[model samples]
Target: MQDCHILITRPEPENTLSCERIVTHGWTAVPLPMLDIAPIEDAQQRAAIRSQIFDIDTFQYVIFVSKNAARLAADWLDTCWPMLPVGVHWIGIGQGTTQALLEAGIPAISNPGHTTEALLEWLKPAKMKDQKILIIRGLGGRPELGDKLEERGAKVHYLSLYERKKPHYTAQTFFMLPDIHLIWVTSGEGLHHLSEYATQHKPEWKTLPILTPSSRVNQQAKEMGWIHASCADGADDNSLIKATEFHIGKQHD
Candidate 1:
């Protein structure tokens, strides 16, 4: 594991923490954020998000799609609902998001798994008929979660708090490409951008093992010609580290 280098595609701040964790396990972690997250700058959009938070109790479930969503939404929530809304269940899509919610003083948060599909599975057994669900996420992403919730007889709304864009990579960033033995893509967008960039700049690096938190990402990676792509148990740092170690062990065996 010491000789293996893992490329982390999570955005900054988060990537720093991931690197520290990977270093503790004796594996070199490379920070190569494929997507950058920025708070929504438009005043209209900010007002819209605040409006949703003002009427937060109207929805039965408030689902945060990722850690960024949870953290960003909580920032607004702190101002709007100091007392916390009643009868509204909070749902974090994964462990990291769940932790963010807990840290924000949101109690009894329901976290199904790392992926949206897992949340759907957990919600399938519930009585969601006519229930309102508010999904907090970035500017644009897959509509699968909202679509599935609507299909289950729930009215779904969105509060887009942040926007994700492709990061600009410099020439020096490409220098680390050769040493990246394993790639950690945390989102579908990250995987797409990383694959597209590598296809144009570092095609040979695509053969390296890629570990993702969801089957959806793994499938997309395979479709993009990343045959070594694998799915970890979840999207947290520990899951990624364990997956990387397991893959390295397999190479030795």
Candidate 2:
């Protein structure tokens, strides 16, 4: 069987697991990271964490918006609180985030699908009126969740634990991409990173086929002149693999 290659543009955890799943299903995975998430640059954020560590008990719910957020928050929790606070519920924004928290020893977690809308839907059942919710997330994310929580009478505290910045596309990311048969883009930001790189350095991608995770990303790809483009349902590895298989199979047929 001829090996197939698929490009991954998501951050870690998702990137890592997506590679594992695609390879397990007998495909070659190429990771050209579009974003690098690191700790928030603000010193005051760290200082606030230190100052509020002991008050973990005051929060009725602690929500992690991504695996990156979950990992950073868990590390900070170990250094700050050290012990798990009683009656504090944990909410993970996606399946991957929930698994990350569970692996980190947080047993009580509410995991919705990977969007603010899904998180809100999951929270609807809990009906946490007047509860204090602390959201540990990355910098400059969508504020819809927090705003809705506040509107629903929940006291919301949003903390930025990390920041997502575009990673430099090394020669490896560009030179090695020609052999890649498929590209799996999870978000518009990830696609924007690729488009920006192509615009500055490699103009060949204007003709390339792209497999995006949503119609939004597909539209973005089309706007960027990617004539051959398709969309998966989401960033989930399974969904990505299915998309790849469908495209590859169609080409073969």
Highest lDDT scorer? 1
- The CA lDDT at 149 in model 1 is 83
Per-model TM against the reference? 0.95, 0.84
**Candidate 2 structure quality by residue, lDDT tens digits, 103-204:** 988865654455567678778744778899988888887688899998888998878888889997676667766466677787777788888887876776
Q: What's model 1's overall lDDT?
A: 0.86
List the global CA lDDT of all models: 0.86, 0.78
lDDT of 1 by residue, 53-110 (tens): 8998999999998889988888898999879988988999888889988998886466
Best by TM-score: 1
Query: Residue 178, candidate 1: how far off, in angstroms?
Result: 5.8
Worst-scoring 10-residue span by lDDT in model 2:
107-116
